[model samples]
Target: MKYLSICYIGFISLIFISGGLFIMSINFLLIDFSLFIEWEVVSLNSMSIVMAFLFDWMSLMFMSIVLLISSLVIYYSMEYMSEDKKINRFIMLVLMFVLSMMLLIISPNLISILLGWDGLGLVSYCLVIYFQNIKSYNAGMLTALSNRIGDVALLLAIAWMLNYGSWNYIFYIEMQKMDMEMFIIGGLITLAAMTKSAQIPFSAWLPAAMAAPTPVSALVHSSTLVTAGVYLLIRFNILLADTYLGQFLLFISGLTMFMAGLGANFEFDLKKIIALSTLSQLGLMMSILSMGFYKLAFFHLLAHAFFKALLFMCAGAIIHNMNDNQDIRMMGGLCVHMPMTSSCLNVANLALCGMPFLAGFYSKDLILETVSMSYINMFSFFLFFFSTGLTVCYSLRLVYYTMTGDLNCSSLNVLNDEGWIMLKGMLGLLVMSVLGGCMLNWLIFLTPSMICLPIYLKLLTLFVCLMGGMVGYFVSYVNLFFFNKSLYNNKIVMFIGSMWFMPYLSTYGVIFYPLFLGGYIVKSMDQGWSEYFGSQQLYKSLIKYSQINQIVQNNNLKIYLLLFVLWIIILLSLMLLM
Candidate 1:
């Protein structure tokens, strides 16, 4: 007989993935057993590999989340997916993705571990474009390409580590001897993380990934992809705690949080908006990575996973029922029909807004508290405040644009509350979104003994959330000066809304970065010519001459390769000099 049948494949995959989680969970709880090791020789040194099948408290906690989300995604897919003839293939890929995530959760060795990471990346791209549409395919392609840059950088970092420290789990714990090599490697790792987590300049690909199915969006945005970057930070926390690059991560993450929050508002596509919000949330998580509390960061990941998945799934249902329309303007007043979905959507929104007693409130509040105390001295403290404000704006807009607006519902309601299968999967998460903080025992994402100074700061975050929701609700509830336009279309509006600076501020920030850079070079050349040869005309002739010279420089892969090699050599020489 074949290895499996169409019907039982998903079941089998789920079982194996669950088995991995279960094993890891037990290990976490029972810290007595040593990690299981698998040995292999890489560069002639025989390395002992540990399969962290045994669960410790930490691994068990995270694996539980991993299992739950993975299972829910699987269950939801049962109903979410149309019963295409090739259902088996889809199930297989889903299982594959689950297997990859499970492996990633407990990966003890970098070599085998990266395979799991890449597996998630591959499946995410494939699943995003699963429907094989023009837009989805393109989105998948670009997203995969962007993620690969991070993936490759991570691999490079691993190579650097292998040369310096032994590739054991304890290597990061003893990084007091880090030298220039480690710093360079650390820089590359941060680069990998920034790209993978969609920090700032690398933020565009995540929004494009909205073309994927809703489950994919939920998985990618919530924990698996973006969290991997945070996870990397946590895993290597000790090594990165006191370094220039570490400080730089803190700065970049804060800026990223602020920018992503801003970007989320600028988007109109439902998924893209959430995608940007995910980036913002991940930025927050990354910012907190170097703090003393790893558990806080981890709990935030859990809470984020719950609500973000719920919201994305809800958005998917809205999109699916509304005949593939993703624009919010086209989808007002879905609450009339999708009552359960709308309710769940509201819960998720409230949770994301960090309304009191919800899951997000605890985590966001803690971060705010931490910021006030530890992060105030990090410079431009107002950026974090603005980030919080923008989180309100974007998350509110997310809720307002989809569920509460006018019933522009031209498309027939084809879906009914995501049905029982999906609902069964989401109900637990929805309930948790509602009362996640109260049920602390079950949701063991955070440590019980965290030394947080929980005072009025928590209340302030709750207040912020409340106000944000009310603002959004009011905007969506009453049609007050309705301007049905996207920020991209509203160029002047984008300039103004992006905080009052237009001409000089955005000179090269977005689409024209390359052109602005080239123009700056030409201007510099003119300045140098004037300084040396006492003439601007000389620069003009030189520009014309370069234009003529371009004919000889055009079209040769060999020359390009040679230039690349020479540039790399020069770069290495500079590093040596440093």
Candidate 2:
């Protein structure tokens, strides 16, 4: 009861906070106002150390969204973690996670942002390893190390920003285009964003982080932690727009989008598939941001958060009922068993697929149309539409496996939607998932973006979606021969299925050579040559000298008699010589 009280308190407090922030954001938006509050911590020489917060429409709205999701996640976890012994600890970690995200969202200074950023990384690691298993340990390590790269990049950016005599980036973003140092800072910031958002080479950690509890997935991966990078880049978009760095980011993010979408199609783990989907959406947000549509990126980010969090919650309910089994192959006919969970899952999935009038459709459709209308290369165009199609492909495939097939679970397993607390959580996000797109569209964009394209181009998104759906459905039925074909094209399947070996590259590929080198050094130097010439040789020499001294000391009387004879001989020889 005490543990559950924590959830209630947090949920209620956060709900009130979220509502207040939302209203404040609206007022700020209507008044065209921003509040920047700065406190000087100290002044050194000519530089003033200050802590700053930027309360504009963007930050407030995002904070509201983050808190809303977090509140619901906490409410959901009351039931989800009810049986756990350490529920209080879990709740505390989650609250800390929320606080870290809030800090990251509101801070305008790089130093303050780093504090939040590092807090997020550290808290996420704790959350990932909450299960206290080998897999969780490995996942947590990978997540921590991967995010460390971004931390390093941010630190370097802060160091570079010292040239401007301030860590407050809001004041310097506009002038960034004019100076080489500013260009370097922008590049560093982009690199930091890439690692946080899990772009391409940095993407392995996002899916691996699914080893975390599903609630953590709902809060961290879906909305706050993963999106921190996107939010940071959104804030820095002014510096990146129309620059070579922006172009480079666009290319990298496009590839990330395509890769994540394609990888999700091949993935089987329920949580991992959703994680990959999050990665895909993040790529979408980032690519759009790099294209200079920061508002659209933020719009998509908010919209993605609602449905994705709902999706993860639905997944959590299903996983709990299924006795913790996560493989999609073992999940079938869930719609018949758990209607509410299934209904919410389907809604979230369709929204993810960009079905018309849903949350994802508004932002995703607009993004695709904007991409079509933009003067980008053919390759980027292919990537955008194709990745959109791939998203639909994976989503439909997931729905088919989990919701539409025969019951594939053990007969002893009894699955039902009995957890009302979890359902309550889902219900809140489900409403938002259904209507969040239209709501955010109006709130974020005062004037609609003018996107003009041909009839074919306009229909292209729909066409790819339909085609992808067909392929996804047909591919599921081919499971009978999947084994044989997979055996035949084993390498190809392995390559595509393993996120193009990104996990290997991030883990074994990164450590194997260094570990081998360290072993070689230990064997050849520490244990071999250095031991012989340094420690071992010195020990032998010392032992030999000690043994000689011991023998001479033990025979002191004989040594004195021998010395007397030698003295007499020397005296006789001296007398004869005289």
Candidate 3:
């Protein structure tokens, strides 16, 4: 009852705040009004420090969406974490997470942004390790360390921004394009964004972070934490677009998208698959932003948040009913047992695939059409469309594995969609997933973007989606001949299945050589040469000198008389010399 009251209070308050923010965002958009509030913190010679917040349409709308999702997630957690002893702690952590995101969204000062950004990292680490298991601890460590790279980069960027006599990056974005120091700042910012978004080399931590609880996954990984990078890039888009750095980012993000989509197709863990898909969509956003389409990226960001959160929540519900089993191979014919969850999952998946009139369709279709119109290289173009198809392939494959076929679990298990609280939470996002795309398109863009393409070019997206669906559906069936063939080519299967060995590379590939060198150094220096020539030698010499002193100081009459005579002779010699 105490936990229920906490949940209800948070849910109701956040919902009210979200509604108010939504209205304010719309008004801001309509009137082209933005409010910037600043407080002077300190002033030094030729430099001043100030904390600032920018309440623009973008930030307001994003905050509204974040709060709305958080409210639903809190409501959902009432039932999800009801049996746990620390449900209140979980709710508080979630609220802290949301507060950090809000700070990041509003802050314009680099210092304040860092505060918010670091808050996000710290809170996410706490959430990831909430399960208090080895897997969760490892995942939390990986997540923290990976994001620390970005935090370091952001710190460097902040230091570099000191050269401009201000940390308000918004004022210097245009000036940055012409200055070398500012350009370096841009590079650092991009690096930070990539680490946060899990682009390419930084991508390994994202799927590994699935050790977090489902509600955490829905709120942090799916919506807020991962999107921080893209949001940073969006804020700094002017510095990157049309530059060498932008082109480099374009390639990297393209590869990231392709890698994530391919990896998702081979993944069996339900949460990890969703995490990879989130990575893929982030890549798409980063790619478009690199091409100077910040609005489109923002559009897709919002749309993706709705559906992805829904997808994660549905997965959580399914996992809950399945006795905490996340392996999709162990799940089948779920549509019969958990029809509401299956229906919501399918809706979210299709929206992810950009089915027409769905939330994803609006932004994804625009992005593909715009990419088709752009004059990018063949490599990137191919990556763009191919990755799109792979998205469908994975979505269909997931649907087939979970929603169709014979029941794969033990018959003794009782499964049903009886969690009404979970269902209500899912239902809210389900509506958004179905309608968010079109609504966002209308709200975000005052004038619609124009795309001029031939019939075949325009139809390419639909064609690839169809083909990918067919492949995904057919590939779900296990044939003995193909299975044997796959077994024969185990190395290839392993490579593709394991995200091209990125997780291993991120873990062992990074630390193996350094650790090995440290071990060698310990053997040769600390234990060997340093011990023998330094500490051991010093100890022996001290012992020898001590023994000599002890012998000289022995209380023997003859030795004492001889030493006194020698001292008298030396004194006489010294007196003669004087």
Candidate 4:
């Protein structure tokens, strides 16, 4: 515990000081000591790769937040996993994850970035399967394979970067001045980012990854792994803007945001609801980024990280008290027993809904304002508003089921928030979730954008919040018996509730047919026709030849002469015909 705390604290202090100094200068700090560790390879025109790090406002700010959250998560885990035999190992994995994320944040070179990127994928797979259950194993495989797609994309991007004679693509972000090679690189990199961020087609892994421990979820979902894509896109925004790829991303990201929001509303698992919420937020970040609002995306990324991490900590406390029951249907009246945990949950939920003066307000509100003022088409506009409302809808439903509902657990259940160490961890992020946005806005956006919208446009967020709250209350709490109807088993309910069957689409839907075909091919080709005609036939012929040779050796000279004469006669007949 002491060792882990010291490591986390030191990182926190370093990031804080570094971010402070960078902000004071308002200029990027490039730490290129690659000459000390540079190397040349003969394969690709003497290509040189350097271990360079960049310390800009974006990188420092993000690094500080990652370290801060990681510190709290490690502190939290000291209690959450205290009863387990592998607590030290858990802490070690957490530390390694933090190290990888830091490497990703600081590195400016594409090659260096892959080190961190692959490290994140590897460590996350290990952490996901830490419990060593079938569920954990399956989830780990899905997560790792899903992320491997991104790793491959990055590798291809590096190969393409060879066109520029350098691996540090950061220096050439304005490659629009060069050639169409930028287009291919930009597209591949964006696709890589999408996979990492769980955008659109690659969205299933995030929810499945909830099979991991809650602390890992808080760290990975909130700040580190998922946000890596957004950060990468932010770095490359100059090259992506005004391109066809940017417009495509804008459309897909908005759809993803909308899909996740709708999915969360129908979700029942307590942790999954939070996971889907994280997905929605990622989509939000991507959409704003696709619209060329990198700073806005960055702002929301930090704010969302704080509150979401806190929210997960609160959920973890509840789950721990409930003895690992994650189903909301099995949990109710938690506030009656766990007041502190409940309060933290409520605060985080409100912040997620963009409650005024809270962490999300400064960033989320600004994003809505900017989107409203922008000249987006009707489809994107509707997606933004509808998705915003869904956020409120799911949040309210979650609060209703877990906090205010009647007692639903077994009579013998004993649940309470009593772990001091866990509470301490929650407090750090809780404070940040409450105040981090305001502080970040002050530091990062020294001069806030001034907007002058009409009354309805300004009130759009409020209207959605109110409507969503009413809908959530009605759907979750209304006495359906009074209406003489039961929609619990409805197919439409099941469809939306199951994330539009995206889990199947991403998992079994992707592999089942291919695996079935592969099994068929293996049976027929490897063991059937090929074996019969090639190996089996060859074996039979070899045995027959050996038998003939043995017979010839054992037979008299007359038999050998007769066989040779017959062979020669047949050969002469074939030659005469030819």
Instruction: State the C-alpha lDDT per candidate.
Output: 0.69, 0.92, 0.92, 0.84
Q: In angstroms, how far off is 128's CA in candidate 3?
A: 1.1
lDDT of 4 at 229: 93
Please give the lDDT score at residue 223 for candidate 2: 80
> Can you tell me which runs of candidate 3 are displaced by over 4 Å?
41-49, 478-481, 512-578
TM-score per candidate: 0.76, 0.90, 0.90, 0.86
Which candidate ranks first by TM-score, i.e. highest? Answer: 3
Tens digits of lDDT, candidate 4, 1-578: 55556545644664475456445334442332122133343345665434677766677668767877887787787778777766667877888888898888877789889999999999999999988999999889888988988899999999999988787877787745346888888888899999999998889899989988999999998999999999989888876566788899999899899989998887779999999999999999988998888989999999999999999999999989887888887888989999999999999999999999899989999999999999889999899888988999899889988988677877567777778888988888889889988988887777656989999999998898889877886788874662334364577766776777877887886656667888999999999999999999999999999998988889698897998999999999999999
| lDDT by residue (tens digit), candidate 3, 94-113 | 99999999999998878889
How close to the true structure is residue 174 of candidate 3, measured as C-alpha lDDT? 80
* Stretches of model 2 off by over 4 angstroms after superposition: 42-48, 481-483, 515-578
Worst 10 residues of 3 by lDDT: 506-515
Clash number for each model: 8, 0, 1, 0
Checking candidate 4 for backbone clashes, the offending pairs are none
* Model 3 lDDT at residue 290: 96
Report the CA-based lDDT of candidate 2 relative to the real structure.
0.92
**Looking at candidate 4, what is the lDDT of residue 185?**
87
Pairs in clash, predicted candidate 3: 359-437
Better of 3 and 4 by lDDT: 3
* CA lDDT, candidate 2, residue 101: 94
Query: Residue 373's C-alpha lDDT in candidate 4?
Result: 97
